[model samples]
Target: MIDTNQFLAQMQEVLEIEDRTLSPDEKFRELPEWSSLAYLSTIAMIDDEYNVIISAADFRELQTLGDIVRAISERQP
Candidate 1:
């Protein structure tokens, strides 16, 4: 099972977000570090860590960090 806390930590590390306010409820796009590179980083992180294949277009459609958690969660066996 994918832990949400681990997800947040990986996001922080990948996105370089030092803010402790990082949470699933937060908007992924509102982050100051958010960019095309960050989007690709996130895709790579999820693919590597969760073994879930997510595309750049799908990441663009995501609104919140929780959406990512849900996406991977649903894919979990």
Candidate 2:
């Protein structure tokens, strides 16, 4: 199972944020580091770290850090 800590670390790595807990209700739009480049980085990060290839549509649809965790957890190896 993909724990929340792992999710946070991955998010921090992709979004270039300090490692921290992102509450489920926290909107990603509040993060200035979030952008097209960050999303691309996130896609690569997830692929490299988890061997999960996330679609661009999926990436665009994600709203919060928890949304990403849920998406990644739903992916098959």
Candidate 3:
């Protein structure tokens, strides 16, 4: 199983967010990661890391990072 901590840390690194008001449980839209560029970065990260291809619109439907991870797993063959 992929480590959630490492995944979240990578997410933080990709988004350039910290643990302050930003959290894994928090909505991406609620944080500075809501930007279009951030979405592109996230899509790249997910695709490169998990072999999953999803769009920012797909991510908008999620509730949290947990949901995003689940989506990535679901797309796995």
Candidate 2 stretches with Cα past 4 Å from truth are 19-21
Q: RMSD, model 3, all Cα superposed? A: 2.3
Q: Write the per-residue lDDT of candidate 1 for residues 1-77, one digit (tens) a residue.
A: 57998899999999886757588899988878988888878888888888898665765677998899988887765
For every model shown, what is its TM-score relative to the native structure? 0.85, 0.80, 0.79
Q: Cα deviation of 34 in candidate 1 (Å)?
A: 0.3
TM-score of 2: 0.80
Which lDDT values do the candidates have, in the order given?
0.83, 0.77, 0.76
Clashes of 1: 0
Candidate 2 clash figure, as a count: 0
Error of 1 at 23 (Å): 0.9
lDDT of 3 by residue, 1-77 (tens): 45667778778878887755345586777775577788788888888888888775776699888778778777876
lDDT of 3: 0.76
Report the Cα RMSD per candidate: 1.7, 2.0, 2.3
Question: Candidate 1 at 11: error in angstroms?
Answer: 0.3
Pairs of residues clashing in candidate 2: none
lDDT of 3 at 35: 79
